[model samples]
Target: MIRITFPDGSVREYEAGVTGFQIAESISPALARSVVSCGVNGETVELNRPIEADARIALYKFDDEQGKHTFWHTSAHLLAEALQELYPGIQFGFGPAVENGFFYDVLLPNGEMIKEGDFKKIEDKMIELARKNEVVVRQEISKADCLAQFGAAGQTYKCEHIEQDLADGSITTYTQGNFTDLCKGPHLVSTGDIKAIKLTAIAGAFWRGDATKDQMQRLYGISFPKKKMLDEYLLMLEEAKKRDHRKIGKEMELFMFSERVGKGLPIWLPKGTDLRIRLQDMLRKIQKTFGYQEVITPHIGSKNLYVTSGHYAHYGKDSFQPIHTPEEDEEYMLKPMNCPHHCEVFAWKPRSYKDLPFRCAEFGTVYRYEKSGELHGFTRVRSFTQDDAHIFCRQDQVKDEFLRVLSIIQTVFTIFGFGEDQVEFQISLRDPEDKEKYIGSDEVWASAEQAIIDACKEKGIKARCELGEAAFYGPKLDCMVKDAIGRRWQLGTIQVDYNLPERFNLEYTAEDNSKRRPVMIHRAPFGSLERFTAVLIEHTAGHFPLWLAPEQVAILPISEKYNSYALEVANYFDTVGVRATVDNRNEKIGRKIRDNELKRVPYMVIVGEKEAAEGTVAMRQQGGGDQAVMPKEAFAERILGEVAEMLKATNLKPEN
Candidate 1:
């Protein structure tokens, strides 16, 4: 008999070679029907895979992320099969599951081609194949035999992929009906399990993501077990497309990119600059209250700086090349990170224990050489500003400092209207077996890891732990947030580093009169201003919160006749610190309102003959409809009150 331990810590004795499906059936019929995959020990595997030894297992259903990944992986295979049937002699490349769905890269035979219009036919063929309910069979074969089979079948792509990527001892293939593909998989039992399918788009991609390789057709798709779920997914996708930040940014004239200026470099228009400054001012105030001392750092640093910090070894080749001095051997680089400069700052002054836990903050703009193909608008940019801070604290103070940082993150999220369920915290720790890769001693690493774990527990943060995900220097706590469209984006990060201090030989005089290294905590509440702004734009659909809006209120005149009244109202708003603009163009009131609404201004204040005579404005709130009419003074007071409330809610301190 073999013992299997379940996630709930319950153990059951079973015969050797008992399959996960059989085990699920013994527990409950519902579990047997719903469980799509199982995690044996720590690795996810098919539910049908037989267990031969004592192990721990967790059954996963469609609701779990892992289960969804397995389901989509199988869906990709089914897609490949349908493509082969639709276009005979199509050679296949990689087809892996993505965060939302799956995609397949293939080379069509001869002169055959695929376009967006071809999606329906392929989707229909996939549905037909799925209805057959053919079982997906997995087989392990020798490298020689696998090569021979694909070579005979004239699948040069598959043959090249196997020869170049797969080792002789680790080779497997999955066959379903008349289609077979090389894969390392945990697929669903059969094709019939995929009840619904949607082929989203087709694009050109380089083979295996190598620019020098042959370009292949990339097909994107999604699948679900029920038609209703597929419908809901499509609906969400539609909403997402409408909320795409790139589109909204263009429509609102907040930011733009010029091919002449360069790709991936975002140019902040006047309105976007106003909004960014406001965001920075808000963060500056918050950091002040949190006992952070703000400082400025250069956009570029000496190349040797990164060499000592270990960034050059990791990102050197991929980063922009160094700039050499005219007559000196010295070279400088556009700073890819702000931590190394901050490290130099700490080492500048000798410190005592009383001066421990020194927090340095900076809104530092850094540059990196992101590949042109990987560039997106604002989100993946070549240059961006980081709301960065580093805390140099005594070893015993790590937990307390982490808790304080956690509070800052929580405050920022709450101010932005992100709820508890909309965000998740990930605790990343170093890999134990490869201690040499990290800088800190085992004792310091253990202390830092435990401190972070305990701090999360004390703060009531329900975080998931991931090993081998830590920064090479230390452990970290990463904040992953879901935007309005349900897409997850990594926003904030807090990393505990014992490595930098050691490398820099940083020390503070302890009470015992001994010099000891202070642990460093690297944190960024807004990971990068560029990326955060992009996410914020998408999340709110360009209707920003009143305090963050570039133009919180637009004074729209009824016509040219009421332009003076509109200017008066705008002046009043400006006096009260509300970002307000007057729309005095020679157009109808309706046209002005529609234009401002399209610009996503939060409030629309209308001034006409009636309002002008009475010295009042008709207020229209975005998405909230009309608010009550009020006199200019009353309106300014109301706006100020709302702004105060927002700042209070965000725990933003007054700028010092």
Candidate 2:
């Protein structure tokens, strides 16, 4: 017997060759029925894969993210199997499960193409195969044998991939029914688990994402264990379209991208700028309370700066080429990160232990050479400003500083209506097996990873650990918030680094007057202003909170005579720090109300004969229902009071 530890810290004695499915069966039949996959010592694996030694295990159901990944991974194989039968000689490129669902790239035989009308046929075929309850079999094969099999089958892409990418010992494949594909997978036990299927879309993708390679037809699809779940997902997709930030941004005149100006560069209009500035101001106020000193950094930096920080080695290809100079042969590039520049700032001064915790914040704009095909609205822009900050502190101070950052993140999320239940934390650690993908010594990396774990434990925060997802330099705590529609978005990050100080040779005098390197804490409550704004737009559906709304109130005139009173009410609101706009257009009050409602203004005040003479206004709330008549002064005070309450900050200081 071997000891198998469960996630709840319970250990059970089991036979050495017990499979995950057998282990689940031992616990409960219901659990065995629902469990789609299991994690063995942090590695997700097939349920039937035997555990030959003592291991830590966690069972996953379809509702769990890991379980969904395993489910969709098998569905991708199922898709390939269906396509293989439907379109003989169709060569496959790559098929993988993504955050939403799965997609497979394939070159159809004889220049054939698949279109929207073909989606149903393909989906029906997938369902037909899924009903067979075919068990997926994972096999390890030699590279030569893999190449021979795929090559014999006329799959040039798979052969080429095997020749160029796969090593002899590491090649693996998953076979289900009539189809087999090159894959490394943790798949569902059987195809019958997939009760519902949908082929979402078809797009063209260059083989391996290289623009120069042959473009193949990419089929996007999603599968669910329950038919009802697929129906709900379809409904969510419709709601997502309605809440799309790009569409709402245009209607609200928030932000836009101009083709002539270049793609992936968002230009904030007046309203967007207003909202962004307010967001900055709000963070600045909270930052000030935490003793943070804000700084401004340039948009370009010397190439050597990044080389010294090791960012060039890790992300050079993702950044624009270095800009050459006419004189001195010096090379500069658009800033891809703010940490290196901030490192220079830390090195600028000699410090003692009293000044160990040096915190600097910047709303620094950075650029990346994102592939044109990968760019999305503000969420995936090429140029964006990060609310970045770095804290240099002693080893003992790391936990305190981390908790403080957590407090700020929690405060910000709460103010934006994200509750504790809606937010989840992830501890991203470097992969132990793949050391070359990261920097720093194993000892330092281990310490940094443990610090985050201990901090979260002390704070009583439950965070899921994900291997190989850390920053190249260190481990990080990432915050993902579920939106109103239950879609998770990564918005905040806090990283602990011991490598940068050593790289930059930064030092501070300790209590014994000895030189010591201070630890570095990198954090961004709002990962980037652009991405956060996009999420906010979708989360609130363009109906922003009064405190953050660019135009909190729209003052409409009933007629030409009341236009003056509209402006008067606007002026009064401005004095009281309320964002009020006068809609003194030639259109009637009904049209004006309709337009402002579409803009999602929180309040609308109608200025007519009685209001102009009585110094009062008739008020109507957005989406109707809340109607009242109040003096302009009373309305201003009410708006201001509500905003003040909403803007209230959480406790800035937490116990160490």
Top candidate, metric lDDT: 2
C-alpha lDDT (0 to 100) for residue 112 of candidate 2: 97
For model 2, residues 386-428, the per-residue Cα lDDT tens digits are 9999999999999999999999998899989899999999999
What is candidate 1's local distance difference test score? 0.88
Local accuracy by lDDT, each model = 0.88, 0.92
lDDT of each residue in 1-656, candidate 1, tens digit only: 99999877899999999988899999999889888888887567888899999999888898777789989999999999998888888888889988889999999978688988898888999999999998989899999999999999898888998888889988999998898889888888887879999999888888867789998989999999899999998998899888888999888888998899988878999999988998888877778888999889899999999999888887787678999998998999999999999998998988999998999999998889887767888889998899999999998899999999998888788888889999999988887876766776888789888888999989998886666788888899999899887889999999999988888889999999999999999999889999999999999999888878888888988888888888888877777677899988888888888888889998898889999999998999886586888888888787778877887777664221
Evaluated at residue 601, the lDDT of candidate 2 is: 93
The estimated TM-scores of all candidates read: 0.92, 0.98
Off by over 4 Å in 1: 1-16, 140-142, 324-326, 430-447, 653-656
Clashes of 1: 0
Task: For model 2, give the 10-residue run with minimal summed lDDT.
Answer: 647-656
